[model samples]
Target: MSAFPIDYAAVFQALPGGVLLLTPQLVIADANEALLWRAGRERHELIGRPLFDVFPDNPDDPDASGMRNLRASLERVVATGVRDSMALQRYDVEAPGRPGTFEERYWSPVNTPVLDADGRVRLIVHRVEEVTEIVRAGAGDHPVDRVRMEAELYTRAQDLQEVNERLRLAQVREREVVLALQEAMLPAPVPVGHHRAAVRYRPAVGALNVCGDWYDLADLPGDRMAVAVGDVVGHGLAAACVMGQLRSALSAAARVADGPARALEVLGIYARSVDGAESTTAVQAVIDWSTHTLSYSSAGHPPPALLHPDGTVELLDGATDPPLGARPEHVDRPEAQVAFADDAVLVLYTDGLIERRLEDIDVGLARLAEALTRHRGADAETLADALLADLLPPGGATDDAALVIIRL
Candidate 1:
């Protein structure tokens, strides 16, 4: 056999993988240019340095499990001795200004003999393949797979954003529509030169945008002021249309309403032909403010609650009948009342104002009264807001609410 001499450095440099040969005491015995470049260190700084101290064994990456993980990987490699692939296994290598970035590196003790012409393991060879990109789903060219996956992800994100934008736009439009219709139903607060007043209406949680909740205020001749609130039975465009008709008819009825009962009879008869049970309930009052008396009527409506100056409240119960939509014969006329106080508050509202499935109507009414009691110090607007907050049940409501607070 012919004897052969070799150049160890040239041989190692010729290899493709990043290679590092470490001495027993942890000094970098030798390292290929590829290893030095990947480690981002100069050749002069590479050798004569401890593996942990020189390489930095990236311990900052939690997935790499830190230094404990780095040491564990070394332990397995030393125990096994045989080189193994790290395609599945993960570890970390130090990076400048970073604790450690993850990577997959293989370790194998070099087969070169320590004793001359004798077979003995002397140096440990570390082969590192940066598997960070692979673990992060950025590894390998994977042209067809990666390109298609990236395109799909981008498309999905765009679609979700577009859908969310559309949803937001639709909500805004819905609110605008509700506000518009509500405005149309209410008469500009007719400034009763001699009377001070306030009105408020709020929609329920599940109530469709713009349903039939309505209110009206008018200064009729004969020193009488007519006020009314009613709910139609439906929602959306149809409900709005019918509500407009009801509001017109109610306003006209107030002209000759005389008393709460007669005007309601006019309404009941009109309702039978227009929208019997299909319509909703309401309470109307014609106030002869000068006399300090109110002529009010109820049609399947909760009675009006009176809040006194002393913070006490009372409800007016009088001739009442089923909602107009039920049947012409089932309707009742309005009632005249002299029971109202000289310096008191009167509140009228739709069913949505105090109706909740979580509590009975009486409880809701009691809550309303309690709310009124708490608002003794509040002006009309503040009192109205407090009433809404207090009367609205836990969770939410499913209908529209309207309120008119009149202080006499």
Candidate 2:
């Protein structure tokens, strides 16, 4: 029998504790029933509103710090993609139907991040439990009892701080492991005969953005060389492992296959069996220095740029097809060849180098072609650095990019 479908929305509303779903911008996307009831608000009153605007600190209380602390905790979660357990807080909620009147409230709150496959925080789960009665009960009539309670609260806060530190350390260690794996997979590019080649791989900037962008270079017999760059669909360890498998498979196929197109066909067949390898985009090219020709093929990736001696740029886009594992049946991939001048340069790269949010891809391709023309006289290594500086933002790229430059 098939399993029953679960209604996630209903389960969210039925949760025992008050919960708010917030975007990274702190806008309230949703609030569970318990939260709406506790705040004395309707669903429409809170949804689509900025969190702080809906529950601002009471203006009458000069010492109020609830909003400030909560904002800090939420921001930390967004930055680190880690959970934050806040200390017990004294937050006053405005009394419903009574303007300018506020009631003293205490809360135990925790903010957790909902991370994407790339390890970036997509949403925040703000869970809170009202503890007004508990705090009031602990407030004794005698000064000695009150002092003891305050001491206990202080200890609890210290414990939470220690836990937060441990979590931060663990996150740091995980990032190190991912970076190490990426470095192990992508080795430095070596020269092919007299042709100088330079490669660059930049992971997306963020805690969880270490992705599966990769480049491989292999020297073939008869003064020929093959280079390929690919991007896996997701990010983190799973994507990296898939990237390693695909890169190795393509590299091996390049040695035995007759052309770039055939190498990609073999890689595509292997990708179908690998988990998390669907819709992977890659471009492979074989440069024959004796013939001064570059044969290339694409699996739904950005075209490689061929810069002529006179600075005229040619985009090798004539032989493009759907990404790997995109189709159920096997089909022969197309191949194209272009004769190059002795001093010409060839560039192969992933889309992150040129793609921007809400912009046309042609615009980015045009920009790249112009940059290549402007710096056509530079050596391969210098040209690679110049292109990255020109194309990437100062803060860094939003997606992983792998670039290969070869002087023909």
Candidate 3:
């Protein structure tokens, strides 16, 4: 009785609950240090192991059935020395590479009847408590059920990235108002004089940000010269104000026409007298250049590809017209006449170069005539950037596109 100054390991390490001793053949003689640090193991891995081989119960995980109903209520108080109680439960412990952490348990059991002085019963006295902080304080009243599912997935990804950044800033302000209304509708790029020199342009991927396709090179007053490409129906700012009224009534009907099918019949009676709030669809051509002939027309669009000088390739597809505000019963065809001999190459485009709709427009027109006959040895801005990298098949084009190239 001289060593009975008992501090029994500070009363079983200040028993908040979770003490053990299950011997009567269930092994695990003693454990405390908070059940050996919640079984992450220590007291020599909890003395002789057993208690169902160190708390094994997860049989198909019903959250390990509250430690398997507290080992069936401590086997009914070790078969009779009776004393039991249980309450706090809830456990979802899955700690293997973490990520799931839930716990709350409260248990009880006590039984005693061992004595070599002439009595026998052995051991049992297990208790545990770790109410996982009262189930995480009742999960703070379910914070609006988890903030209404993270505010509807952050408001549908912040409204689809704000409508794709407002359609890429309205296609960069409609290509800066289609280059300030195509520089107030054709003012200079010279050649309205230099006999036999014309240029029409609208390549830079147009109002997809190139501004509604456009181009013209005139030298009218002497041995005429006129070339064109146009498209204006839908796309920002009413297609840049109907592409400056069909490029200023096509430079005032190619300076009072005499070719390109009477300057597209004077721009189709100037597009059936506009005012349906602007609309367009054009393609004109005229190059006499001292009898090196070539006249054209096509009030609807997309059919102009001629590269001769021995690499033979011509396509000004037969008759087509029905685009400008589409009515007044339109019709202005025939523009495939060619005699552009010496090193010729004329290509006008505006259905974004041989339209692309996943093959078959005759296979995107035989893949734009085999990529303009395999870049016919480039150089016209590398054959218009290798025919837009061989008709965009590597991610480019959800819709809008444009291009135009001509070299003679």
Candidate 4:
């Protein structure tokens, strides 16, 4: 024998508790039979109407807080896409026949969000259990005791709401502090002689708009400039502090070292001592305008791109090595140099610019090269923006990205 298919619509109507389907705007879309019976209202009166309009607060009661609490819970579900369980609430509904009379009601409500394919809240499932009879059961035998119990419940609900508000404020303050620290750590790029250069730093999206990515540009002695991009291994305030220290150490090393490889070697040594700095990746490059040479070294990072005037691209991956602090002992890092034409553009970036979830790194590199070749004719600033627009998603990347573009 074959089994029959399930009817979801019928099941929804047969649910034991009062259920309401609401839009993100709090409009009443549908109501189950149990809810219609409990609320003492017909389907036509409640459907196609705003939830608050249909069930407004009891105007005679100045202390009525049912509407406000329910609205807050629904709005929270829409904003964070998380479920909210409301405490016992005392609400009074209008009588079926009397126009101005109200009947006392108690409810326990839970609001849940239904997300679409793109992780956006599409609808809200508002389920409520009526407990009016339980609240009034001991009224005849012990009226004073019933009043005391109701008061205690109301006080507890108020305390919970206050605590939730405090937590939300604390989270906002923490995010603000992190953002300010990130801005202070990443300073503006220093002028690189007469070379046209542009740099862009974008943190990851969401509440914590900060991460462990950094970029540096400094003018070296003898008509040369050094540019570096690095990624620390974490997020939040701790990773940001570590990033600041490593970036400053590398900048100091680059000022005194003879070449890019020696500067990274110094950074690798420093990273081993700092907490939360292991497995960090960085690429340091120095461009000499006099000889038209680009010298670069990498510590487990993606290669830099060189776009020529003829729409040709070259990736500088010859000097790649393991990430910082990956080895048990110190090892000499490798360095490579390539000659570029005067009209060539040198691009150095963190891995977030091209990397995507579950995709091959080589595929991302190929995509970057293609984008660079197509925009070879643009200026340094324009080229930087174009590369980000082409490589990043419409909503932005999941990791931090630091980019440096220089016209040779």
Candidate 5:
């Protein structure tokens, strides 16, 4: 399987128009030749540069509307993902020759957004056509004519802003519908044979859109209970629908397969057959109290934390395969076993529980182990609540968080 789901860099270069790829933070990650031609610079000079740093407003001029207008237009494009066309921009750039000098330039620029699989902006496509001649032509017009032109431009900008607001409001409503559908499909807390299990799910902050995080508990034959947690890549309605299908398939496979390992293998097959679940990460476990054994398998997922009765914490990092749909060949889903004693707790969770921006995943895992160790004696529900309250940010989480605890 390819390392990157999409080769956006290649796509950007192939396009005929000038293009710039920006990170979510608005830093330039790449630039195409058509864009470089306008700047009179090579790829290395501008590839990793910030947009404003590369072309700041000419400081010598008192009316440097370049920076002000450009910034406002780009902000609108990023926020709304709507294509924006400016009437005429007088943004100026540094002159190639004299040091500490500025050059005046006129341009008609258009900005558009490039979205990733999750419906989030991954890049911004900025295209410009030099309109210096056309703009200069208007210089001979009467003063009153110029004022009328300026008023028309202002009216058009207002119309675009109104349309953009409507688009954002509609998107919010659609997200709510998807969230309701996902919530309705989730199973309630239930008993699995002799074991009792509970799950907690929280949607990510901002619009409460549906995501692909899900957890399930199944009662298997002969005193066996199965638990699984998974996260699908991306968000919105398509991801939620794929998550629902995978959850049902995994539950059915757990009941028929010989063990957790075989069940994961079967699930991989089903995941590939489905249209949207190939990039999912998951962990599945079958706990048999009668045998006092816990068998589990991981598919490119964070290992489960096991809290022993004697205050020992163990992260079950066993032989694991790549995410479900990444491999086409037969995958060997090995099941690792550990002794399950009465009153011991096993915590299964999605990556959101331990993943944070700017923090290493190992650090997050260590924090979880510490939290579980501190609350080793509490009931499953109390422990879950404490973990969330302590770990999640006060402002709110940026991704969906789901965790399941099976107390034996």
Candidate 6:
């Protein structure tokens, strides 16, 4: 009715916690979605009603303090024009479909005064946090004995603290083991011929243990060499063990298989036979230095990016089959080939490098291409460092990422 329009319903409902608006006389004016759900009442039933009339204390119960405490807090907020917080109070709500009955509820409520331009109290914002679960969960065997309830809560808190400490120590030990496994497995001084090779690997931050990201380099019978980057399903000792097994199996298959495609096919078969290597994605490639040819195969993995000598970027994203161990039948690992000019860099990476929660993979892929174009003409190590810096600055990755760059 006033000249000023207040369309604050949408804004208040957008808040994460429960919010209620009360008039200067302590009458219910509006309530947000959170508070409506928490109170289990309709907007028509609460709005334009006096607060005490809607939620009066039980007359038969001598221990009813909800009305008294809430009234005292709201009075103080109105008098001093300051915020006041009430201790946890058991406020009962009218039972659904029942006329004059109530259900017990506990809430931690805070009352804040909203002042008008003239420094007069316009409205009161009542925010509540339900603490019934915490109270009921810690209730002791003797419900009437306050001393027993407090003692039980103290004992439970000590037990929880001890359990947390043990879990923390176990996580530390698992991380050390995963790190040692990675250090022992990942190739160092990567095997290279006429072209240069540089590798970078970063484990996910705040990981309880380790992840299943790995990279390997192996020499073939011809002047070509095999390189691979892969990720298993999960983290910790189980995934780390599976990664080691798959790496060894892929390396062995590369020696006997005809090309990169065949090598991945063989590796897929081996992974299916393993206990934990199922549902893994990998990119395997054989680069021939003499012919300057690259033959690569993918198994449900992100496509590789090729940075030409002239800074033109290409994504070798061809049709791919499902990940290993997806089906009993052998999935075809499709291979793609491209000839590279001198100083060309080909990067094979895991999804962690280019995937983020709630974002399209195309966005990340474009960023990767841009980074490659910007860092043209740099050597393998420099290019890799630059790409990692651009894509994953500090504390960026939520999953493990590995990169293998081959410069011809």
Per-candidate total of colliding backbone pairs = 9, 0, 10, 0, 0, 0
Please say which candidate is ahead in lDDT: 3 or 5.
5
For each candidate, what is the lDDT?
A: 0.65, 0.88, 0.60, 0.88, 0.79, 0.80
Worst 10 residues of 6 by lDDT: 152-161
Q: Write the per-residue lDDT of candidate 2 for residues 159-251, one digit (tens) a residue.
A: 776787687677666667777898998867766666668999887876666789999999899999999999999877888899999999999
Model 5: runs farther than 4 Å from truth? 1-140, 208-210
Q: Candidate 1 residues 214-309, lDDT tens each?
A: 887777786678788888887665676677777788888878866667877777777666743264677888788667788788877887888888
Each model's TM-score? Answer: 0.56, 0.70, 0.28, 0.69, 0.69, 0.68
At residue 159, give the lDDT of candidate 5: 66
State the local distance difference test value for candidate 2.
0.88
TM-score of 2: 0.70
Please tell me which model should have the higher TM-score, number 1 or number 4: 4
Mind giving the per-residue lDDT tens digits that candidate 3 earns over 1-408? 656688877887677656787776667888787766664556775578787655555455553455555565566445433455554444344443343433333222333323221112357767666655554555456878545643443354345445645855776676777667666665454545544333334334323534456666666765666778777665555565766776778767777866665676667677666653245677788767688877787777767778876565778766556555555654544555667875577777676555553444666667777777777766566777777777754433433445555566
Please give the lDDT score for candidate 4.
Answer: 0.88
lDDT string for model 4 (1-408, tens) is 339888889999999999999999999999999999999999999888999998989999998889998999899888766788998898889898787788899999999998663335679999999998887884445878877877877897898788867866775676678778878878676567776578888766544435788888888998899999999988778888999999999999999998999999999999989999999999999999889899999999999999988999999999999999999899999999999998999999998888876678898899999999988899989999999999876666667889999998
Write model 6 residue lDDT over 1-408, tens digit each, in one string.
Answer: 769887766779877778889988989999888888887778898899999988788776676667876887787667546687665566777776786787766687889988652234679999999876777666645767645754554465445445645755777788888988887988795456544589988887543525899888887766888888899998888898899999888888888888878888998888877888889998888888789888888888898888998899988876366788887887566788888887788899998788866578999899999999998978888988898888873544657889998887
User: Which whole-number lDDT from 0 to 100 does residue 245 have in model 4?
Assistant: 95
What is the lDDT for 140 in model 1? 35
Extract clashing residue pairs from model 5.
none
Best by TM-score: 2
Q: Pick the candidate with the highest lDDT.
A: 2
**Stretches of model 1 off by over 4 angstroms after superposition:** 1-175, 206-209, 275-277, 328-336, 393-396
Show model 3 residue runs off by greater than 4 Å.
1-96, 99-211, 215-225, 229-248, 251-253, 257-286, 289-343, 348-394, 397-408
